[model samples]
Structures are given as structure tokens and as C-alpha cells.
Target: MPARPPARPVPPAPPPSPRDRLLAEAMRLFGERGVDAVTTREICAAAGVNPGAIHYHFGDKDGLYREVLRLPVAELDRQLAGFDDPGLSLHESIRRFIQPFLFDDGSCNAQLFFREMQAPSPVFMETVAREVGPLFDRFARLLARHAGMEQPNAAIHQLAMGLQAMAHDYSMTRPMLDAFHPELLADDPLLEQTCHRLADWGCALVEFERQRHASR
Candidate 1:
């Protein structure tokens, strides 16, 4: 009787917006093919939805790509924002930050990240450099801190670029894993292991850089 006095309202199911569908399709296609190779029609075809969806959602191909990349970039932003300056040790700090770039978000929706990594669109690259680039620079500082480099300007920048190169392999070589590094193929359990290992390796690289600087 008490519950009947105030019935709970049913929550509405979230409707998929036209833009959302198009962006999702764009991510899938872009992940499969190089950015230049993915066409609008192809995106529409793969989406199994109307061609106009892209126009309605994003106006143009570049717009669609930006929308797609926003997902991963947003996540990157959130993780970086939560960086605790005091609590994280050097190795822990590097591993925590680097995992998102290389591993799937436990949902396997890593297409947009892979696309950008493969062929870095000028528009997207500029956007990242302005926004996420600072985050990477900050993370590079974390690496530098562990490496004991007081001034990490050039050295840490190189490490940041190296981490990016390593992450791209997950999407760049989806098939070649059949013959080489099959265990390391992203589809298997090995990928998670690989990401952690790479984090350690990245930290090690920074450590070496720190040593060089210290020696000087």
C-alpha cells in the first residue's frame, strides 16, 4: 500500500540518435581500413542504416571521424584528469595511464583510437595536440619523475611518441598476428599482458633517458 501510493516511473529506453549510429559505423570501418580508404557510402553500407544518417549526425566525413574519435579521447581526458600527483609511484603511474591507449576499454570499442593512431588526420592530430597532447606531456612528466630527469623536455617527448607507436600495432596489424606474435594478437588474453609489459618497457625507456641526462 505504501509503494502503491508512489509508483516508480519507468525509465525511458535511450533512443539511438542518427549521429550516434553513423559515428559508430565510421569507427568500425575506420578501424578496418586506413582513414583515407574509408568512404561515406561504405560507412553507410556497413551501418545498415540510411546514408543521410551521417549528414544528419556530422555534416561531413571529417566531422564523422571527429565524433568517432571523441569516445576514446573523452576517456583519455577523464583518466588524465583523475591523475593523482602524490599517491602514484613512478611505475604504477606509467602503467595506469598507458593501458587505455593500447587495450580495449573492456568493451572492445577501440576503433576510433586505432584509426587516429594509424594515419593521424591533420584535423584530429591538431585537436589531440591541443587537448590530449598536454595530457601526454603531463604523463611524460610522470615518466620523467621516475626516470629522475628534472628537465624532460625533449627526452620525455620522444617517449610519449614511442608509446603511441606501440599502441598502434594493436590495430595496424590485425592479420599479421596469424603468422607472427599470434599470442600477442589483440584478440587473445595476451594483449592485456602485452599492454602491461609495454607499460613496463616504456617506463624502462624513460629510466634509461633519465640516466643519460643524469650522467650529463
Candidate 2:
């Protein structure tokens, strides 16, 4: 047999760009410590870049924090795309809207969101209004359509908020669930079952509101 040729060594992977590093480190630090507690210097040190990198990449720490905040919102928007489709059944709409929360990836973005909920930065409300508010409004409008309202009212908005709170609870209370009921987290089918049950309840609630509105 002919001698085998020597294998060529693989080239080293390229290092993360300074911008990517800054974003990643900022996400970690902001998620763990909240934006107020974290500083530009700490983020730069963790990213292994100079403090100037933040300004170059994101203008400043506030700019970086805003970008970090948007990461999860972008993911949410992707997941929630088409949730308000007119062709979807009300149950499916509810399911689609809430499913992301149940099967949350538990990424750093989620932690950052939780941190923001607990202690929002100056940018948080503005960001939510600009990005997340439209999503919520769309869901509310869907609910109104099912409930026979010309538009979403205060009651419809309240209902939308309540459903969101329920979905968030399943994700946000995961740590407690893990400590007390580990099997719940481990069971995907069980989570799906719970999601379906919630969807059914949501449908019933909408029907009830529809009847109530009709009677008024």
C-alpha cells in the first residue's frame, strides 16, 4: 500500500470581533447584576477589550444596554410573528402567543428581561413601548375580534395582560419549580399538556367575554 499522506492541520477559528465580545459580556453582566449595578469598565474587562470599544461599538453603556435589551425582544418578535393571523383559531392564537414563555430557552436574554422587570433602567420603558407594546396590542386586538368587540377595550387589555402574566409565571418561576418539582421541568410532554390546558382556558375566557359583551 502507498504511504498515507500527512494530514493537514486545521486552521484556528477566528476570534470573536470586539463588537460581538462587548455585546456578549454586556449581556452577561447586565443580566446578572442589572444595568445600574454594572459598569462599562467591567463589561470591557470581561470582553477583554479597552473601555473605548464600548463607545466605538455602541456609543456608550446605555447604548450597549439598550442593544442587550433588544436581543430578547427580537427573539420574542420572531417567535410571536403571525400569532395574530386572522386564519388562526382563537385557541391556536392563544397557544402561539404563550408557547414561547413555556418553552423558554432560558438564555441570558431571559435573565436580562427578568432583571429589567425587577428594576428597569431608564431605557427599559421606552424600549418596551417601541418594540413589545405593538405585539401586545396585536394580541389584544385578536382577543377583541374573538370577543365581538369593534376594538380592544380596557377590559380586553386587562385580559391580555393577565394572560401574559400567567405565561411569564411558568417561565419566571422555573427555579422554584426546579427546586420543588424537578420532574415538571424535565417533562416536555407535560409542559405541552399544561400549555394546551391554558389555551382551552383562554378560549373559554374569550367566549365568556363575548357573551358578556353581547348581553350589554
Candidate 3:
């Protein structure tokens, strides 16, 4: 029998670097005009890639939105490694979570990260829960514990939702803060103040829960 010809050398596929690529573009556009104003063309323009790239890579604008949001979510997860603080003080755990979003020694990563969360899309919100739920849920239990609540209570999750609501109040209005309250919103000042405020707000709730838990 004749020997088979040598197999053609297969080239390794190009790197998807699209995650970072799309993220950078999404951040630029979303940060500039907010999410609704910026179209996929703008994202592609900022990204210096074809419009098809976004569709080819992320399924659609919403998919790209998920990927954009995921960057920070994944970053948060990395910083939170080994944070098995199911029993950690709720206020402190909340503080740790808030710190990453509010502060970054690096350049625009922090600011860009925050905009996505601040100006959420419905699509982003759908994925956001699944992506960030467990970590925040653990913090919910910690909050309940700090308030001396027993397991299986709805209050714990509600408290978690409250924390998000509060943070979102400040974070979602960040552009307004920067424009109308620039000094307070300066990254340095905001980062510093946000960390303390988040803890203070969280701790304040702990006291409220304590009373409620005791009353029951």
C-alpha cells in the first residue's frame, strides 16, 4: 500500500483578544455618551475593527454588553479569591466588595468598570445576577449574621438588595457627581469616601437589623 501523504500543518487560531478589544471599545463609547446613545458602529470605530467583529464574537449588542460587564465581574472575583467569609462581618465584607469597584491604582480600568455597572442594560442585569449572585449572597448571609438573624430568612437577601440599591444610587449617578459634584466625585475623593460610606451605610443597616432581629 502507498504511504499516506504528510498531514498539512494546522495553524493555531488567532487569539480572541476580542474580550479585551470589545471591552475597551464599549467602555469608551458607554463612558462617553452613555449606553443608549452609543451604537455598535461607534464601538467598532473605537475598537478599529469591523462591525461584524462584534456580532461574530459576542452574538449581538446585548451579548457585547454582557462581555463588557463581565470584565469587572471577573476582576472582582479575582480580588475576592479566598474570601470565604460566610461568617465575616457583613459591613466589612460589603466594604471589601465595594473597595474594588471604587478604587484602582491603575488608570481608567476602575472608571470604565464602574460605568458598565452604573448604566446597566436589561441584558446586563439578567446576566449580572447569575454572575455576581453567589458572592453577594454570601455577603447577605454575613449581613444577617452581623444582625444576629437565623438562616433561611428573607431579610438577608433583602439587605443585600438594599446594599446594591444604595451603591447604585451613588455609582449610577457618578457622571452627575462628576459634573455637578466634581470635588466629591474626583476618583481619589470618591474612592476614599465611597469605601467609608459603604461600610457606614452597611453597618447602619446592621444596627437596624439587630433591633428587628431582636424584636422578633
Candidate 4:
């Protein structure tokens, strides 16, 4: 038999760009500690980049923060890409809408979001309302369809927000889960089960609303 040739060495991966590094570190810092507590210099130091890199890439710390905040919203938007389709079944629509929040990526995005919700800065509130409002409105519209309403009312919006919060708790309350019931986040199967349960609950809520609306 012919001798086997030696395997070639694999090339090393390239280093992250300054911009990428800044965004990553800023996300971590801002997520763990509120945006007000995190400093640009600290982020630059953690990212191993010069402070000016933030200025060069994002114009300023506020710009960098805005970009970082958008990352998770972008992921949710991608997950929700056909969420508003009238053809989708109610169960499937609820599943798709809440699935993104079922798993934690171990990033600070969820933390940051919840933190902003608790005691939001003016800038954070403005950015989040502008970016996230349309997504919430879409979900409310889907809920309205399930409830047989022509359009979403304030009650429908409240229900939509509550359902979303239920999903958000799975990811955002990791520490509490770890301390209380670690099994909930122990595996993919469990997460999927939770997602399905939440979807069922959402359907039930919609049905209740539909019956109530019909009675009027």
C-alpha cells in the first residue's frame, strides 16, 4: 500500500475587526451593567482596541450602544420574518413569535433589554420604542386576527405584551432559573416543550378574548 501523505496544517482564523470587538465588549459590559455604568474606555480596554476605534467606527459611545442594542432586535426580526402572514395557523404564529426568546445565547442582550425596561434612559427608551414598536404592533395584529377583531385594541396589545413577557422570562431570568429550577433550561427538549406550552396558552388567551368579543 502507498504511504499516506501527512495532513496539512489548518490556517488560523483571522482576528475580529476593531468594530466587531468594540460591539461585542460593549454588549457584554452594557448588558451586565447598565449603559450608564459602562464607559467607552472600559469597552475599548476589554476589546483590546484603542478608544478612538469607537469614534472611527461608530462616531461615539452612544452610536456604538445603539448598534449593540439593535443586534438582538435584528435576530428577533429575522426569526419573525413571516409572522404577520394571515395564512399562518394561530398556534404556529404564536410559536414562531415567541421561539426566539425561549433560548439564551449567553449574551447580555436580554439583560440589557430588561434593564432598559425597568429604568430606561431617555436615549434607550427612544431607540427601543422606535425600533421595537412595529414588531409589537405586528404581533398585536396577529393576536387580533386570532380573536376575530378587525384591528388590535388596547386590550389586545396588553395581552400581546404579556405573552411576550412570558417568553422573555425564560431567557432573561436565567439566574433565578439556575437557582430555583435549573432543569427548565437544562436541555433543548425542555425548551421546546416550554415553547409549545406557551403557544397553547397564547391560543387559549386569544380564544377567551374571541368569546368575550362575541358576547358583546
**Which candidate ranks first by lDDT, i.e. highest?**
2
**Model 4 vs truth, CA RMSD:** 2.8
Model 4 vs. true fold: TM: 0.85
Candidate 1, residue 163: Cα displacement in angstroms equals: 3.4
Clashing pairs for predicted structure model 1, backbone only: none
lDDT of 2 at 130: 95
For candidate 2, the lDDT comes to: 0.87
List residue ranges in candidate 2 displaced over 4 A: 1-14, 177-190
> Residue 147 CA error for candidate 2 (Å)?
0.6
TM-score of each: 0.68, 0.88, 0.63, 0.85
Clashes of 4: 0
The runs of at least 3 residues in candidate 4 whose Cα sits more than 4 Å from the true structure, single-residue gaps closed, are 1-11, 174-189
lDDT of 3 at 103: 42
Q: Across residues 90-164, which tens digit of lDDT does each residue of candidate 3 receive? A: 556777766655444434445554555667667667766888888877767677777877662687688777776
Runs with alpha carbons beyond 4 Å of true place in candidate 3: 1-19, 82-91, 101-120, 152-154, 164-201
Candidate 4 lDDT over residue span 1-216, tens digit each: 999999999999999988888988888899899998988889999999887988999998889988988888788788889977889899999998988877767767877877888998877877778888899999999999889999998889999999988998887676787789767657754478889899999999999999999999
TM-score for candidate 3: 0.63
Where model 1 places Cα greater than 4 Å from the true spot, the runs are: 1-12, 29-61, 79-84, 104-118, 167-178, 181-192
Worst 10 residues of 1 by lDDT: 103-112
Candidate 3 local Cα displacement, residue 167, angstroms:
4.8
